[model samples]
Target: MKLVTYRHNGKTSIGKVEADRIIDLPRNDPALPDTMLALLQGGQDTMARARAVRGDYSVPLSEVQLLAPLPNPSKFLAIGMNYRKHVEEAARVGVQTPPTQVWFNKQVSCINGPFGDVHLPAVSDKLDYEVELCAVIGQRCRRVSREDAASVVAGYMVCNDVSVRDWQLATQTMTVGKSFDTCGPTGPWIVTPDELGDPHALRLRMWVNGELRQDDETGSMIHDIYAQIEHLSTAFTLEPGDLLATGTPSGVGVAMSPATYLRAGDVMRAEIDGIGAIENRVVAEPV
Candidate 1:
């Protein structure tokens, strides 16, 4: 089942997506709560209750505003150059692929919903887009084993990890380049892990203004999702609402022969199989 957080009547509420319409989850359900994260924190039982929800409180597809699947996560970690092709592309630019997983943090303020506009920040001119498979944690755990890591995942969503190449390269760390407000665009809806088994086998693709840029399968990932979780959990607790970007494939603008970068008025669309797509326009901010 596809789950979503939406705004209607100027208020945000949790809903389930069914047949292109949103089946609004009733606030007064005896079992499940109203908020998306709360429902997730309630674990599998709440999911069962949400699945049993059946009603036509659903609104038309075009009627309401869809918000980020998890509005504010406790932590947002990203794996860098985990795709083989992306690593190869990075090698061309002198950024070597790591033997272990390369991880970084994205400020929560960077998060934005699907169909939002991403600002080309005045501080940098080399904005780039990365299409990646991202997952949200369902349960809290520290030092989780690889075998138990996948079970802790609540759901998956498509994320565009917008980067400022210049800012990223100067510091040798991606946090600054990756944390611009509105840089991260995620969600049309979140697909529960049960519905999207084998996260590593999905196809991830990205387009810049209708031109296909990155097109590779998650099977190409150097360090797959479970490994990433185990690796990260060893260092920090994976809390409920924690988000992880599983990394991107090759075909980014910076790796192109001519080296293209996004400018004001450009658009980007990213999609992953099972999880839907997210599209965002580029607009200039005042310098």
Candidate 2:
């Protein structure tokens, strides 16, 4: 089932997507949780209930303003240089591939709706895009093994890991550069693991102003999702509603010879097979 959070009648609600219609869960069953995070924390029982719900009260997809599947994730983390090609591209610019999986925090404040506008920050001129597949945690767990990682994942979504190249390279943490407001664009909706099948085999592509920029498959990840979970859980508990960006492919603006960075009015479309796409436009930071 594809789950979404959308605004209708000026109020936000969680719903399920069917074709071009959004079946509002709360309207169908008053007992259901109204928010995505709350519903996720309810676990399997909640999901079962969601599955049993019928499309009694639904609105056209065009009528509601779709928000990020989970508007407020508890922790928004990302893996870096997990793709061999991307790592190789980094090496050309003097960045070495890390011996172990490298993870960074993308401040939750940076989260934006799948179709929201991305701002060309007035503070930085070197903005870049990284198309990645995002895994959404279903249950809270720590010290999970690679074999058990699949059980903890609820769904997947497409994400654009927007970066400010200058600040990222300037900092040791890479948090500041990755966490700029409106930088993290994710959604369309979450496709449950069962529906999505193999998370490792999806195709990921990114286009800027109608020009193809990045193209690769999820199978190319060096660490893969299960290994990443095993690695990250050893350090901290993975909570429901937490997000993990699986890392991007080889082609990115900074990797280009002349560095073709984003400018105002550029439309960036990031798509992952199975899980829909998000199209965001670049605009000058608002005053």
Across 1-287, the per-residue lDDT of candidate 2 in tens digits comes to 99999999999999998888999998999889999999999999999999989999999999999899997888999999988899999899889879988999999999999999999999999999999999999999999999999999999999999999999989879999999999999998999999999999999999998899899999999999999999999999999999999999999999999888999999999999999899999999998
- Clash pairs detected, candidate 2: none
Candidate 1: list runs displaced more than 4 Å: 28-31
Q: What lDDT does each candidate get?
A: 0.87, 0.95
Candidate 2's C-alpha runs over 4 A off are none
* Model 2 error, position 254 (Å): 0.5
Model 1, position 176, has a per-residue lDDT of 85
lDDT by residue (35-124, candidate 1, tens digit) is 877888887788888998886467876889998888788788899988888889889988886878888899999999988899999888
* Model 2 quality (TM-score): 0.99
lDDT of 2: 0.95
Where is model 1 poorest over a 10-residue stretch in terms of lDDT? 26-35
Q: Candidate 1, after superposition: displacement of residue 108 in Å?
A: 0.6
